[model samples]
Target: MDHLQCKVFFGLVICLWTAKISQAYQTVENDLTDENSLASSYFFYQRPEYPRDCQEVQDHCSYTNTSGLYLIKPDGYPEPFEVYCENRQDSAGWTVIQRREEGIVYFDRNWTEYKLGFGFLATEFWLGNDKISCLTNQKKYELRIDITNSYGMSFYAIYNMFRISDEVSKYNLASLGEYSGNADTHITWCKINTGYENCTCQKSCENPHECLDTCDDEDICICPEDYYLMERLCVPRKQCGCHMFEGILIPEGGVHADSDCSRLAICRNGQLRWDETYECGNNEVCEIRNNIRQCYCKPGSIGDGADCITATDCSDLYDAGFTESGVYNIKPTSWLEEAFEVYCNMSDGGGWTVFQRRIDGSVDFYQNWTTYEIGFGSADHEMWLGNKKLYHLTKQKRYTLRVDLVNREGSPYYAKFNHFRIGNKDSKYQLLQLGDYSGTADTQSTPNGYALTYHLNQAFSLWDEDNDAGSSNCAEGNHSAWWYKNCDNSDLNSDYHAAWGSDASIEWYYLPGSNYNILYTEMSLRPF
Candidate 1:
């Protein structure tokens, strides 16, 4: 063959071979794409076994019905760890950060140990500082502490918002919102030793910024040279006693009366405890004000806490220096049965006895005649002092009635009467008398501003009682107990409505709008 023909023939053969190889490569790529799609589908259908928290597990894992020890993989955490899930308390889905039931685990640990965490989840455990920081930083968390004391009494403290800082900040508590609970006091327990055996630990109490040196190379905890070990806890010689009452550090052994002299607190063996030093009189109560437990005369009572005497009314209590607004026991007459509970509004001049009040929809005002005559609801919350109680209170002295109300928009208004009184059950507990009216609750129908006066001379009616002159039962129509003249010009004891313009809402008409709902209502009477 010629040289040119040979070169052309080899070129054609090489082109064909290249095309065949390209087609084979395309087929293999298509097979790999199909295999990849199948693998992706397989993973997509797989269950999410690793939950971020107990709440996620409760929501996603149907089999996880009961609360117990469970593994949770918190965000930013290295691996999953066991935590006690409390599904029974309050609602479900609570990750218990710390539990001290059997006291099998010693909480005394160094910084590194605390950061990494210790103890078994089944027994006592603190879910490590690092893990907690990671979990809390991921989202908002509420802390609920359930404590059962030595007396077998149970108490719970709930902090609405909680969070902590990262390791760089030593995992300090970054945020803690408002606290609410039944417990009277809040206490923070700081361990003296951060190791297995009780050992002295050097901590800079003077320099608050400096951290404590928990352990040494020999694995034994060491304290400052100046501090001595007391009851296996290290404390400075000057501050050997229990640290309490806003940094008031007592010596190793000390005894002092509490701020209010109500209790005697003793410091012994690096621990502080309290004993009741004084007991209140019959008409006195112990209350914690600004963390200081003190005894004071109750409502409608006077004298020192140890020797309180029953006062005639809220006015008497007001004169005796009982000024805080709250529920107080008032005795209208010398008779033992005449003493009853009433809310005393000690603000805005003081001594105003609240006979009827509705703040939240916690109490039901709709009732039978018997219920209205006696009373309903609690003295501290929403309550009606009762028609019988009201008659006795007003009969004791000439009272000025003040009706305070707040509309849905939170605008306050009031109606005041110079003279107010009610008749006994013989008159169906009628609102027998009302004097000159004045105030912002204007009827607009009348020349003067008093709107509730329309309800005067009318007998109080409940859902079961038909005393109104109107064709239909006013109390029944309004679904509340009230002094209804014809139907009602104003109804304070009506059903609490969230929105405005409801027929059954607690309302005062002709003030600004018709049938406007009142968010709060308080009918108080004060003796002039």
Candidate 2:
């Protein structure tokens, strides 16, 4: 083939090879980019067509998923051009103006070449000074530069405000606002020369001056003065700390308390160690539980110890500001009384104090009278909210009790009573009143209707304390604690069972047919 023909053929081959490389690199980059870096670029290659501009591309990232090379037509541009939509940055909405990787394209060129731009779009290339000016002039723009050295150490510099001048003034870097990055303060200038001649080895945190007498003929690069060598890069001397938490560099030998002040952390010789010395704030106390020191709000107060406030019942909290369903410390009594946590169901209407909950059967509810009276298990998980607490809470206000249950088939049913009250422990915490039941759980045609009504006016019973008027120990037969007459129409406190018609299963009878398996059950009460 002739020389001219051979050149054209080789060019075609090179273009094909580069396209494959670009595709591979893009695939790998997408995998490595995390959800946090998604803000760096918005438009993906999957976008139906070219966007109007880079700003248009950024607006799409919220609902769109992918990020790669895309075509864009700026406001004043005559024709559309290809540009990279980058989403692998700290923030979003960026049009990559320039990129240099492995120096595949030589940068040294005449003024004409720089103005018009050159090099491959996917690999290493400049988007031309003319195009950059057009893009920046159309809208406000910021500049971010990512750099990686020979040792694979990476750093970034960001200028809050940046703009390029038109070609009239030779395309000068017109406006450059505040500069911010994790780099040394003295990085204002870059000196390019042979290693030893630049006093590279003499630079150190203690002595940052140019070497005058101890100059050696070895090629070595050392950190600048008032700077330390970290990860083979020169960093500010002030940054010589241990990065043990959330990528924050702690000062050398410095101690800091965690967010909750539960424990203290000390940085020593680039290492971090935690101490059990808790520094709790006011209205807080430090205690050792599960082999770790923790801070807890003091009696009659509610909080995670760092900021404690006076505690009140769930109703008062709902009226105040707390509107989320979770475990909250509440005091039903006066200021002098201690506060305890209760799972408050703050949804639906709000301020429903949960007395009992069974989710996954993780907590064993088969207990004696004292255990049932004082309560057991975590407030965050499955637990009985204690009969004593129930009596105190109910006595404070006229409450209506509501029982919410979910069966094995994921169907929900609720039982509500207009008037519900419990007697003190002296009466075995008897269900003194359960007036006018209304709910789907009692919609059966049986003569003994209203499932929960069977336990009304009956004293609470446990295997060890049989207050039930049944022929047998009802709590022992069902392996649960509940108010029982002869037995119960709804044994919600029974062991979790998957099979139907099992006597030991947590059941709500008659309404859903006899002895049906229930997956979840909760009993809560609130004042009208």
Candidate 3:
């Protein structure tokens, strides 16, 4: 061949070789991205695609028997989806994307795929369609196409995806249908520093500072073995660092002074005191109770101690603010009913929802057919006579029984309980499912096959808020009294006042008392 003719031939060969290497890398990348997206559908922001490959047709992860594609993602998502070829038939062959009954499936002539991106980490190009074509006979053709990559992906080496994406995005949708290829989707080639890439990737690494892992302070040491980086250096495991209880947990990044080494503490993702600990304002102790440490009421300083453990607890529960009718109708439901359905009214003279004791000293919650007392874990509820938790009840031999709360632990502090039927230990089945909750005394086993030894009240601990180191302004709180060298009543009382122990504080407020026969308005632990 002449000099020019030989050069032309070499160029074509290099082009073909380059295409194969790009295709392979893309195949693997698409697989991983697809996998991550399948794993996270709800929390992530998935991009749009005209996916025609098996990757797009269905949600395999969600189905009983289907899973497809896995793609490795970068720290984040890609700015744009790189489109490789102008639309073209895979040299030759076919592919199809379809929905059969409940699922979407794909039949392809070539092996094509899509990838997904995560919100965190490096940005990856996410969401794409793999239009593949198999050539039983060697051939290639042009096709039209559109594609986007919202999931950002990273390769151990540089520009792996930047170059690979070019070969991956191309297909003639007009001609391709699922599983219509004559040849299986297999493209082959190799090497990252080849000619086709034209070294577009070289510019990327020119600035070392541009690398994702690059940090301003190389002097800062890497976190030691088990320890991880916080602001910088390695650190030991932190203890549970909760600052509030009876509310949702406030996360603690690491262990700090003033926290007790209570409960099993594990440092997750460098968070030493995460999902645990209760912190007190100024001077307070994070007390551990029932395997959980919550903010206790400081000596004399009291909070209902109902929700001192969770962030959810700190929030106020306004009346549905009105009636089921929609406005201005605040009411409470009766607790421990014996034979009547009494309700507390917010409009009543006495704000308290008082219960009317029956002639038999019984509150008929179910019309006297049964008598019950209730119990509670927290003080955030529509308290019957100022009490939500009922400890005792008087029920005649065999009568209809029903506790009147819709959900167990109707409030944050209450224990969760639905009526249980008595059962025999050996039987391993509910002997009676509380038909009207009127089952016979179970001599065989406990109600839930659990030893029927402790009552609901006795099963849990009593680290009331009155014994903590100190208190904060939040009302009805439990904490310690450190200001007082000793746990003295006088000092405790004084501290309570300092923390706003009187009514009007958000933590505790006692409404004026009036005598009335309403059954549902008081705030305590009982369900309304």
Candidate 4:
């Protein structure tokens, strides 16, 4: 005991036997973080003689910190067991041990092992036991633990075991101790902070759209009706004007009235002004009627009080009267007077004819014939009054040629009687080319007379009376009546003499005035 005090007395008895084995492993890890003998062995192994019946709870008990464990018990109440810890660096750790009769157990840290047995360990058991054999049958048991440390620092745990009733009510070896880096076995009941994860403590939100949920205890940010908090984001409430127009919104200082109130527009901030004292009067023309903003008149004009005048007149045919029966009602004052003058006091003799038209589709008949010579030049041939040769148009009789055209010149050439002939006065005959009158109202009065041998010799060869028998070549022959004007009366060989074909030459002092001529026309010949 004297060699340096015998090596300092065995190094103080090996440092007091290593401090009494580190105070007996810190008093058995502080009795597994004491909870009063694990809550009285979990209510003494789940009282009611527990054979797993919490009414057999099921509904796949919920848990999800990223899908880890679930052990249903919906209404019988077990649903609160979820523990996940993944702070990051390749974090890996998990453990779950359910066990009603005896089913579920999984452990991992890559030491992977899983089991789920029931009623007699349903085919598998030992999940690397930390303390297995618990529920001898008085059911109820649950344990979920997840610890992540490979520098990913994390931890979580949950344990409940309200039943097990058998083998000495197992599982209290200080509740199967294992967590080491103790800050008193640190648990702090989970807390993550930012988007929450078991956070029973730290929470804060500045303006994730004006508080989308996190900061409470009055840290404020509850904005939902028409929103409003700017910097912290909840926005949505600045209307001021709204102005749309075609899709019609127009709101702000709103005015819009106009269907006679002339037009008063408004809509300020979104811009759409128009009231200059309710406009539209210098001949008026704004438009857009029923849905507002209107003025009126501007279509050939005519509205007077608020201004608009120009509609000149021209629209009277007495509503188009003479409805059928050789239809005749002629009136030509002046929508430019196309051709006039017709006095056919004829039972067979009272003439005076003028009727003209020519913009190329020729039509004329200046036949004074007996009222003393006014027929010498532009009447190439359409004249067949009646009684002259005793109603002489016969391919076996059927005639009703009524012409009551008024004021129609060249706008599609009018005034009928295009070509006519009836033999026996001339002989070779054959020049029946009939009328193809022009538009703006015409009535051939066809009760049945338009069928003269199906239009004899099919119209338009005018006069081939045996090739002009006594030839004045009838004005350049080959069937030429010189396009009417002074009457090229085709002599059907000797005595029929009917004429038509005049596009110009009726100058007995050029009898008509109006610019394009042909103002009124009326010719009638009947023979049914």
Candidate 5:
């Protein structure tokens, strides 16, 4: 090769080698914001097999091109595991640690139950002391999660229960108390649904070429996770019960009494008999309910009244501000009214105001007045409302509120009735809006910043909704977050919360922050 040619060839080779290595070593990580995005692997708890604690917990593991912190709940060891400092996605076998982001990625074992506190969704099926049981598609089964502390390790375990529309559908499910001895004795015991222990270390190989005669993984071949395997061969797993499983199988026809079949046994013609255990249908929690053994039931349908609703209901709850979309409305109660004696004073310069029972957050609008009264004063006598005292205005009531003033000479603020908190007593919160019969409420306007409308840039790319983007828009730093399309969903977690961008149509009014100790009557414009 010529000298010039040699140099070009060498450069090309180096570039190809670098690219190949990058491809082999990179992994993608993102914050787990959407509950739907979590994997089944995350919820699996084959106690007697895996401890059920978070594994990507050391730091946020990257998947689908985002980075986030993860944590387990319910006071197991490592109470608040500060998972990843910064989340990054680098290739597998690659050393890309320095790219970690500076935020938290969390694992929410508690999310399942957190959705239930409202008492509107499924009730009474949750395992452990907590109650937010998710019903899987299987016919006679229910699934719940329990987070427990074991020797300082956080164990997130799932409880599988049985259900029955017919008296026959119910089963008295039981599990072997996880074997407590060393791997040698192979001892075990029975208990209800709880506590997972590693069954034993299996040497089954992932690569067939590497198998030493066993040609399989040592895992107990649990359902769902093991659905890919049939007779130990990989296949698809979905929702339901089929072939058969061990237990006193429900007879082919309708009958109350148990036959000869035992859990781990099967049913052939019309009888409960023994056969190698097969995968139970979807939704089955692998328990011995009633006098039955190894039977299954759909999740959330313990009895006649407890059945889970269809997928339609699930979507409704998912949309019900659970994602923290806009400014959530706060309701008003009697204690709040008693706490603040709202007054509009033209003589003492009190102006118009809505007082909260506690430290006022901010305000949006005040009814029963002119539009002129809600903005900043254009003149000295602009008779506009003021947010002078957040904590203490020396009033008869403790007013936690949002005060609005028109055309404020200073920075403008925007907030909804949902933003204020009221009452040291009752918590019947309500947003003081036009109350369904919409009416005009004076609005406060402010100077604009590109803060909400940044163009395509690196910052935009950083907030990619899909991993498909290689070249993209995204700006750097904290300011870059709001510019994206879904910042509301992305930033609503309590750990790293950011108020979503606002739409001017909402007409926000809320009290600004209080430093009453410094200046009692404070006013500021907030639009978020």
Candidate 6:
């Protein structure tokens, strides 16, 4: 051959070789059974052309026993359908096959390709039309054959070949009758027990309980050893406690404490029990320190290891001289300047004493505001002398309060010294100044007309004056005075007084270079 002819011939040979390899690779094995040699022969045979005389099967085509294959349902009931194939005489040996289910022929196909040899048969078919062609719609369709040793068995085993087109793979829809003589048995506890004579099945439980094998009856579920049942739940023996203490389970009447030995925790009736006896001494109080309970003295009291005493016990020091010399400074500039200093010479009775003397050129007031209640003096101490204490000021009690005033820098307006026993330590205290003494006064009488007692029994109610500026006296430059009978006494034997600085009066305001000072003050209680 010439060079051009050789090249053309070689090209043709390459094309044919590629086509054969492609066909072999495109062939899929019949995975439904291992007893068949049908897959190998199916791809080796040449496919036939479309049948010209092929006709579409009608919607209602009667089926006859042809291929004679049947399947058993999953429920062990025999399926009523059988496989059938009808030969089309005009279609040149082509045939149409279908399977009937429930008296209905649901699957039908016409084969244009086949391989019949090696005691097996494999056919490629389509569900579309009688004219056999390559699958164009990609719908699931299958047709294959298997020859097995069960040749002498039932008809289902003899010609166990079948196919389902339309997205159903043969392996997925194949029945047990096609592959085996006996039906498939589902393995369950009851079935296993029934199959074996000596098999004893125990009850199954979801909870953590022991399963009991009841040989004579249904199995029973019971708690394990040392476990108790509560509401059908098994609880361990160690958890049978009333409550937990510090994350350690504690039984009823159990006592536990931390390693530091501060508080003793007790559990009772599934709860932590609290006892006042576990607290501090009678005069002392309990307090939390570093998350542990400890005993400490209450406010205004000092405590030793055993007992508590009033902080103001001045029995050791001699009596300090009393002073009525007090000067009211123009409403104190700040809380720090709102106080006066007094000196008690150790001649008077001890008790609470006050002294303000110049030490190192600076005034030492002998008072510590931080030690009092809310930065105010308590009954047990000498600090916060100006703080209001209505609880200590009772009805029918005679009280003598000393006062002194000095205006270091003279003022254009007159200022007064206002004393009050207010309901609370709030803005109401400033608006409810009870007694006002101006000019150079050293002593002021208690139960004055401006005291709270004065308003208790008045014909007009004090609450009605809530909106009255002069009565409420809450606004600046609108201060006034009021009086009422003592509410504590039904006989109205005593009266109380209240007063505030009026317009243009600098009662509580203090200005620099203008010293409105309270030089001294002394308060004493006496029996009525």
Clashes of 3: 111
Which of candidates 3 and 4 is the stronger one according to TM-score? 3
User: What does candidate 4's lDDT look like per residue over 1-528, in tens digits?
Assistant: 110110110100000111110000001123555556532112112222211211121111111123222121212332222211111233212222332211233312232232222211222223222223332122333333444322234444444432222224332333322333332232232221111122123211222233334434433223334433333333334333333444454445655645555557677755777776776665467765555455665543445325754322111111222111221112222213222122222222211122221222233332222311122212223332222221132333433343442222323222234444344323323435444433323234432222222334321223432233343433234222322212332111111112332223221111122211233333443332
lDDT tens digits, residues 150-193, model 1?
32445566676678899999898887677777744421232332
Preferred candidate (lDDT higher): 3 or 4: 4
TM-score of 5: 0.16
Best by lDDT: 1
lDDT of 6 by residue, 357-466 (tens): 11121222222222211323332333333333321331213222222222234433222233433333333223243344333321133333222223432321123233
- The lDDT per prediction is 0.67, 0.65, 0.22, 0.29, 0.23, 0.26
Candidate 4 residues lying further than 4 Å off, grouped into runs, are 1-255, 270-276, 285-290, 300-528
What candidate 1 gets wrong by more than 4 Å, as runs, is 1-300, 305-307, 443-445, 498-502, 513-515
lDDT of 4 at 311: 24
Candidate 2 residue lDDT tens string, 296-322: 666536666557775556776777667
Top-down lDDT ranking? 1, 2, 4, 6, 5, 3
Decide which is better by lDDT, 2 or 6: 2
Ranking by TM-score: 1, 2, 6, 3, 4, 5
Clashing pairs in 1: 202-223
lDDT score, candidate 1 = 0.67
Work out the TM-score per prediction. 0.45, 0.44, 0.20, 0.17, 0.16, 0.21
Q: TM-score of model 1 relative to the true fold? A: 0.45
